[model samples]
Target: MYRVWGFITNYSLLLILGAVIALIWANVDSHSYHTFVEFPIAEHFFIGEMHEGHRMLTLHYLVNDLLMALFFAIAAKEVWEAVILKQGSLRGKKAATPLVATAGGMLGPIAVYLVLAMILGSDTFDAVKNGWAVPTATDIAFSYLVGRVVFGAGHPAVRFLLLLAIADDAAGLVILAIFYPTGDLAVQWLLLSIAAAVAVFVLANWLPRKLDKGRELRPNSTWVRNTLGFWPYLIAGCISWYGFMRAGIHPALGLLPIVPTIPHADRAFGIFAEAEKHLTDLLNDIEHKLKTPVEVILFFFGLLNAGVEFNAIGDPTWLVLAGLIIGKPLGILLMGAFAAHVLRLGLPEGMRTSDLFVIGCVAAIGFTVSLFIAAVAFEPDAMLGDTPVQAAAKMGALFSFGAAIISIVMGKLFGVKKVEG
Candidate 1:
């Protein structure tokens, strides 16, 4: 319980605070709130939103496009560690069911969102179609907190839920990169990102190790680690970010190409594991250093993104909610059961099939990433019957908190017994 509270305070509380403030401010005085969000810091800046004939750096752009990259980088680090480390949770047959379940989790929301949009009529479908990815997000920190409350720490379902959430994050990143381009695509610029990654990996990571291969002290590697520290990777990350921005990819994901270029620990203790704080590897060190800043970035992120006027609620809102509340649980149950029973990928010991539905319910709280996807999925100016489609979709994401109550109720109704570690 202490750990759960700690994690929430560290990662979630500030975000919630920011969101609450935004909601109140927007409702109280929408013009002032929006003005603050779009306040221009600089014009003709190297990295900013394109406006008129020049680039303009706005408060919103700074938080969303630049600082948010660090947040996504941290997420990429966890995903990388989960896939690459020797004791990775996502490795081997142990992850088969969860991985398959993850697919269902994403597919189900997409299916639900699109089908409902179609049913609403083609004009509505065309307007809201791009936001299909919004409901597929599972806010990992909140979901884990809710999961612990519902199933206790020791429940196999808790671990299963974590695995599914992590996998869902990985998939979400891929979707963001591929489907949510920020501007007109320019494939050639991606070469710069690739070059930056390879150059840094070789010069800073691989070369030092290669030089110190036969040395007992590993002098060269130690020198690079101590003397150079994170500078090379930082420089590479900036270049990669510029590359991604020029390539029309969302710059928030730009740091991804650089995360893997940095050295990491041989094993991971999983995301949110207390043991991870003790690891001194460069990757973990960087993550630790960025933790507080990322928290603040998330605060600003929530502040800028979650400010939907209550009256903005419309078709997109209900569609996103339906996708999460209805689609997520059914998808997880059906696909999870199919994987466990039909595909011969067995559920973790002590995890009942019924637990999958509850995990799905918990996973339905897609606040953070869902808000981000909503922001990008539609133009801010896009409207549906006087309601901003983005705001309506964001309201749905915000309302996903309702899933927490639904999960607890379902847990009780399903006879899910708590298991304390």
Candidate 2:
């Protein structure tokens, strides 16, 4: 039993377990699963006398809006450290090729989606066109798992894919912000969200030191610059999350603005990179504390969100599959090759273009964030009431399972072998 717990906890096996359970449960008794997901957490409530704006919370809403905010917070911190802080392979001109390749990853899917949508022109395709961003996301956890399988634990191509996924996530955040908003836009709340993020940044990085003075303190003290010492971050996170929620955007994105502000050691080189040992970066500390909670949250996330009825599959399904499996890899390869020739860039040592090709295949797995985008892109309302376009988008997300198989096969074809730890 202890060994089982250790294995599942070690490599995000719990997350996979959760997704598999959800799929099987939903398929076996979809009505029960659906009812549970939509089950209200609280009774309906109203502020004004007319009860004009009453609201009720549901399980799905809580998981996606609230818990996933932490997930995005972790993602935002990593991206900030990598791209802006020059951590990981995103540092110098030598890193320029991968950065460009990241752009290709985004543009390629979008371009393929558009062309396919145009060719398959109809009212049906037009209705679901907003889902173009769905195929663009790379589930950082699953992609990392597949890459580890394909290229061992420490291959440079795996590092390259990690950086690529981070950059892809940054791009996805932008796309979500710009393209997907709920209801009429609230400018005041948007500004408030920005203010909250800035305040969090300042509180996390500056206030602790000002309060601490120059006194030498034990490193283990909660009052010292550790996780507990940074209580203000939790406050700031909540405020920012509320701000985005009210501003009619996905609240998961609330974490992005505050990440760069957290004090951190300089970014490290390579995948699975570590921060400076002796020095404490508050963001790094927060990430460490969040490790287990994030895993738990991801399990629930997969459980609640991955439940898709087969009837939801529609015209949008094929388009999404094509973009993820075909466009994603092609885009990565073409962009990397372009940069290598035009700008005279080279792959990380012992890495080759063929290895990149396999890495690109791994890039095709999209879930979590992709499902979130699908939900956002096909929100139910008058024009599309009770339709399955949203369901089809989700079906495509589920189809990303095929991308994993493709990666493994392509890895073998390219001579990749499992490395013993």
Highest-scoring model, TM-score: 1
Off by over 4 Å in 2: 1-11, 43-51, 84-87, 207-228, 266-280, 381-387, 412-421
Overall lDDT per candidate, in order of appearance: 0.91, 0.74
Show the colliding residue pairs in model 1.
none
Q: Candidate 2's C-alpha lDDT?
A: 0.74
- Candidate 1 Cα errors over 4 Å, as ranges: 45-52, 382-387
TM-score per model over all chains: 0.97, 0.85
The digit string of per-residue lDDT tens for model 2 on 1-421 reads 0122333354356666777888788778887877777778885663333236766577777888788888788777767767666545467875677788887777788888778888887775678788989989988767877788788776777768877888888889899887897555675887876787777655555665666566576333335454555576677777777778777777778766667766677654433443232346676777778878888887887787777667777778888888888888888988987887777787777787777678778998987678779878887532222247877788888788789899999998989765533
Worst 10 residues of 2 by lDDT: 1-10
